[model samples]
Target: MRTLTGREAVREALTEEMKRDEKVFLLGEDIGVYGGAFGVTAGMIDEFGEKRVRDTPISEAAIAGAAVGASLVGMRPVAEMMFMDFITIASDQIMNQGAKIHYMFGGQLNAPFVLRMPAGAAEAGAQHTQSLEALLYHIPGLKVVMPSTPYDLKGLLKTAIRDDNPVMFIEHKKGYGEKGEVPEEEYTIPFGKADIKREGKDVTIIATSHMVYKALNAAEELEKKGVDAEVLDPRTLVPLDMESIVKSVSKTGKVVIVHEAHRRGGIGGDIAARISDSDAFYYLEKPIKRVTGPNTPVPFSPVLESEFIPNEEKIIEAVLKITD
Candidate 1:
């Protein structure tokens, strides 16, 4: 095994996939020469040449539309929107075209492609910081994948590239610099599965991306007070590892869902509802808790932004209340 940053792991996934498949190419603004906004694709252009690592103009819609067309004709394209906010500019191509083509055509053609975006907040301001996973999760035809660690990032990205469908591979802005162990050999983590980052029996803490780390920290703090919290990362929101979540809740007899996204209409609500609808509902010792951001838009000021997103304090309070 090798330890690497999230950015390095993603780069490795793209590089290996490009080497294994000639049809796999990357297209985005500043991806070729500039190495992407986060430098994740820094040296790819030099190694693969301009054709495989293209640098497009500042047109999000055009980039998505072209990728959708390319995927239809047997190309596996990975289109990157520098920031997740810019993705709204290409919603038509993504939601209507890339997401619906295969199913609408009765599986005659597959949109075997991926749309990558840097999402979540790390003091980048309102427009640059958003956990918009809820939007993609609402769409039936798209696969929404979010990785919380380096190992998951590499394996999941590889799976997304090879799958015969459109995937929204969300890279949390704050997770890229974080490092973790990843296997040197090739691997793939299947979608629709949950990873139990930490196991506990008191309460199940379901989290995503950076929130996973926060939950784990809160769990550690709770341990000192004799409260154990299990941390689960659903990984892929669309296929949503609901079974694992339900099973965990059945054992723990309690659950708390957490995310950095705005609380209203967030994925936590869907997860909570799924549990409430399941046979595991009777196992609860207390009501399922939810810790999330405020409903207001992300703020540009550091002070206001910090207050906007949920933190470990909030997670701790919610968990403590569930236990009490």
Candidate 2:
């Protein structure tokens, strides 16, 4: 076993995939010599060359559109948006064209492409920071994935590249430097599966992306207070692992959902709704609680930005509110 940062894991996945499949290629702004906005693609250009690791103009729409076109022609393209906020500019190409082509063409054609988006607030202002996976989850034909750890980042990226559909691979901006243990052998985590980061009996904390780490930290604090908390990570959003969620909720009786997205219309609300609708509802001892970002734009100031993102204290409070 070896340890790697989230950025290194992503770069390794892309590098291995490109070498494994001739059709796989990458295209994005500053991804070549610049190595991407966060340097996740550093040193990739020299290893893969210009044709495989391309640097495009500063146009999100063009990048997504080009990926769609390439995928239609039997190529697997991975397009990167410098920031998840800019994904709005490419909505038409992604939501309308790439996501619908396979269904529109009677399944004869499919866009097997992966769009990598670095999301979440990291002292970046409203214009640059946003957890917009909820918007992508609304699209009918697209698959949304938000991985928290370096290990999951590598495994899921490989799976997304091989899948015969459009996948929105969302990465948290603050997680790039986070380190985790990753094996040297090749591995791929299946879609629609949940990873139980920590097991407990008193309460369950279901979280996504960066919030998963916060939830685990919260769990540790809860244990100090004699409140055992189970942490579950739904690695992928679209094909959610409802079975795992239900099982966890059924055992713990109390559950708290956490996400970096806004409290209103966030994935946390959707997960809560789904739990209420499932058989897990009868097992609930109290109402489901959510620890999420407020319904406001991300602030520019470091102090305000830190307050905007959900953290360990908020998660612990949410768990205690329901468990107590």
Candidate 3:
């Protein structure tokens, strides 16, 4: 096993996939020689050449559209948006064209592309920082993935590239440098599976992406307070692993959902709803709690941004609210 940053794991996944399948190619801004906005694609252009690792113009719409078109003709194109917020510019292509083509064309055509976006707040201001997985999760045809660890990042990205439908791969910018153990052998984590980062009996904390790390930290603090907390990561949101969620809730009887996205219309709310709707409702000892970002744009000030993002303190508070 080797310890690697989330960035390195993703780069390795992309490199392995490109070499394993000729149909797999990358297209994005500053991805070729510049090695992507976050340097996830560093050295790929030199290894694969410009035709496979392309640097596109500053147009999200064109980038997404080209990916959709390429996928229609049997190419697996992984397109990257410099920022998750800019994905709005390419919504039409992703939501309407790529998402609909498979169903609308009687299964004759499918868009097997992956749209990679670096998301979450890093004091990057409102324009660049947003946990917008909720937007893509709402769309019926897209598969949304938000991996927290370097191992999961590599495995999920490999799975996303091989799937026959469109995938929205979200990388939390704040977690890009985080290191975790990753194996040298090839592996892929299936979609719709939950990874329990920690096991507990008092409460269950369901979180995504960067928030998973915060939840784990909160679990540690809870342990010190004699409150055992289980932290679970959905890994992929669209095809959510509700069975695992319900099972955790059944065992713990208390659950708290955490995310950096706004509390309004966030995926946390939806998870809470599903739990309430399922048999897990009877297992609840108290109302489901959520520790989420406020219903406001991300702030530019570091202090304000810190308050805006959900952290270990917030997660612990939410857990205590129900457990006590």
Question: Model 1: runs farther than 4 Å from truth?
Answer: none
Alpha-carbon RMSD to native, per candidate: 0.9, 0.7, 0.6
- Candidate number that wins on TM-score, 1 or 3: 3
What would the per-residue lDDT of candidate 2 be over residues 1-324, giving only the tens digit for each residue? 789999999999999999999899999999999999999999999999999999999999999999999999989999999999988999999999999998988998999999999999988799899999999998989999999999999999999999999999999988899999999999999999999999999999999998889999989989999999999999999899999999999999998999999999999899999999999999999999988899999999999999999999888888888877
List the candidates' TM-scores in order.
Answer: 0.98, 0.99, 0.99
lDDT of 3 by residue, 27-110 (tens): 999999999989999999999999999999999999999999999887999999999999999999989888888888898888
Candidate-wise lDDT, in order? 0.92, 0.94, 0.95
* Cα lDDT for residue 59, candidate 1: 94
RMSD of 2: 0.7
- Global CA lDDT computed for model 3: 0.95
lDDT of 3 at 179: 98
The TM-score obtained by model 1 is 0.98
- Residue pairs clashing in model 2 are none
The regions of model 3 sitting more than 4 angstroms off are none
Candidate 2 shows a clash count of: 0
Residue 4 deviation, candidate 2, in Å? 0.2
Locate the minimum summed-lDDT window of 10 residues in model 3. 101-110
